[model samples]
Target: MEFFNSGLRKNITSVHPAYFIIGGFIGIHNVKYYYIFLSLIYILSVLGNTVVMTVIIVDHSLRTPKYIAVFNLAFVDLFGSSALVPKVLDTFLFDHRYISYNNCLSFLFFCFISLAMQSLNLVALSYDRLMAIIYPLHYHVKVTHRFMLFFISFLWLFVITVTLFAVGFLTRLSFCKSVVINSYFCDHGPLYRLACNDVTPNYAIFVFATGLILWTPLVFILASYCRMCYALLKISTSKERLKAFKTCTAHLSLVAIYYLPIIFVYCFGASIHPNTRILSLSLTHVIPPMLNPIIYVLQTQEIKESVKKMLKFRGRTKIATKN
Candidate 1:
């Protein structure tokens, strides 16, 4: 009777595993080449984002609400990639597969938080742009550093709270089943699905998070662009229209690079191969961080001028040192 009672208690209690094996890159042929590509991408992402952040920091002229949003985007990109890439290489490339329960939760928390912030950071930028274009007369008065700071701080608070709740909910689940996570990292969906207990709440969290973090931002950005388009059409001359449109080019490029692949994955994820999907998603995470700074440098006139000024000053410094 004691043995049967023990079994019943064991069945009722949560069986949290000590470690989860990261098998995201398993059963794939010659994936080392892909790992090498990730290594290169990570390196570029770090360098590019660092430069953009540095430029924004040092150039007093770039000190505006718009640049603040740009700075946050760069930081978020660096952060998101830093959270994901190194761990991926450690697990898949170096074969450190077993992640402890606490560490796995921490990992998932960081990743989701960064992703949420990335999407919302774009919304912040769109707000800045909307004010500049739609309300040009009051742009200066309306879009202040104080306002952006408050808005971003609010975003940080909300995203952290929701993500913590999501991660916290994982502790409630009983994972008596397989501990091998099939995704590239400690993904929310795959990790929660492995639970032996009912996972309807986790599924609810997934839906809520996806809609809030992904779709909401995209829809808001689309609306902002539509409004900008309508405002631009009122401009009488083609030259004026072109100049206004130029302002949004870099931002639009960034939105495309960051969001399009995600849109594709969402639309066609079921039809795609798992390995292909993983690669595509990974690219979306790493590639945008690399390209974002490049777009700013190339497309934004202010950033371009700032770079030129800095390079000229460096050249003068070199000449002075030689003398």
Candidate 2:
């Protein structure tokens, strides 16, 4: 409460026309190492997501609702990272920290949309898994391609609409004397914490919007997994249970990694060190996206089989040329 009140007091200062993003470093001996490390992460996240999306598009066998969801997740991860990481790199490495008011709001809008969209995609993936496990015989029938398309469309619409509402109000809030953001990106909390005006309305809408966008999907995922556990219990054969668990392992890992930092950043962030907070925030943005394809898609049997077949075909072509 003291921290929150302190933050509030900090907000009640003179307004700045623009803002500077103070890229919080991890106490590295050389800041270049940090920049290089983040640059590697950004590159890998983009490449990984691109590979996943390309595989989904090119591999006709993977043209299903499941892969479609994977594609969407990859896209969101790519979009989200692209939105934040470049700006972060510029701020830290190139000293382009000063962001105009419009640009700051733009960054806030896209980043929020990315976060919300990814959360919703994970929720959709959970439903996909649940339907597969619980309605195995009717999974395709129950979750058609059209249904998935509609669901994804609605998710974008809902998140964008809510994000626009939140960011629109955020842009109206008056920022004070300190134009420097402590975190790497234009996070809503830090931005609003800089506001000089009464933030009660914005804060209320932010909480409600956050709950709607982030927590709602998380609740759905937990509930789905709980039911999945019950369904697994009903399966008489250990083999079937094992198979179900194996299928879910990746999703569960992703869900855990993605949400834990989010919970920390939102709830217990004040208790954490500033450097650790910055690292956690960066990790939340980078780690899951970088790992999603490796864990969820590339490790799957279908992709392995496709790659094997492609390699075999290439080998045959080489043999034919030699002959």
Candidate 3:
């Protein structure tokens, strides 16, 4: 194990994988410039997700299982961005490319686990919306707080176990040649390419795992939305149907943003132009964290009102305390 760790470290530090080439024109300049952009995105994401989480936790009105799921999604995004962005920023700003082998493995594992959790949370949110739209009377009963807690817990455990297995599989391989990862963070696919040993089993396992994490939830979400649309169509009341449609539209938009780039990158292979890789990476990392908060504020009126009320209350409290 010590030898393996030392070898991994040496391999990773030996060469600077021309990641800028992956960015083409945009990445032409020093990587520090790119890190500046990534840092900005990271700061904004932290603020946005923190506010969302705060709103959900503090506002009693926003404690529904549906919103709880949103909170969890925000939490996942928070950590997911943290996992990749800091290292990326360090690399760009400090020219620090040497992530210890253990840290690299840990980073990779955490990222996948967080991503899987985010995907699972989306699945839960979709189901919650479906229940609300199709079976309003039983929605609350069916998706109790206990149920939400249990489901979220289950997702964490399951994804962690699966991610650990994947990481373990990765550790078994040797890296004889190129140690410099092509991308910013320790992405699984690029890392796999650097392995010296035959990786057929690793690739197969990755395919299965990726399908389970990405495709399965997506299929379920699509099915749920279709059923939801059908149910909405049956509702003759214009107001009721309109409300349902609005919710569905917002959720579908979020789903598209979250899933589409992921599918494109994972399914299509990363052999595209370097510019394409950078764009895909930006979409996968930057856009979703930025967009999710916007989607929630737009789709859920209660959140907007809560923000207004909270601000107003703070303003009044400040005046009263001053007097």
Best by lDDT: 1
What lDDT score is found at residue 258 in candidate 1?
84
Would you list the rank order by TM-score, best first? 1, 2, 3
Candidate 3, residue 156: how far the Cα is off, in Å? 0.7
Model 3's TM-score against the true structure = 0.88
RMSD of 3: 4.8
* Tens-place lDDT digits, model 2, residues 173-194: 7765456666787777777886
The candidate 1 region of ten consecutive residues with least summed lDDT is 1-10
- Go through the candidates in order and give the C-alpha RMSD of each one to the true structure: 4.7, 4.4, 4.8
How would you order the candidates by lDDT, starting with the best?
1, 2, 3
* Candidate 1, 199-234: lDDT as tens digits: 999899889988998899999999999999999999
Question: Model 3: runs farther than 4 Å from truth?
Answer: 1-27, 266-271
What TM-score fits each model? 0.94, 0.89, 0.88
Candidate 3 residues 1-323, lDDT tens each?
23324445543433322221111123455655666777888888888888889988899988888787888889998988888778666664666666656777878898888778878888988988898889978888998888888888888888999999988788777766656566767778778887777889899989999889878999999999889889989999999899777776667777988888887876675578765676576558777877788777777788888878889999999999999
**Higher-scoring candidate on lDDT, 1 or 2:** 1
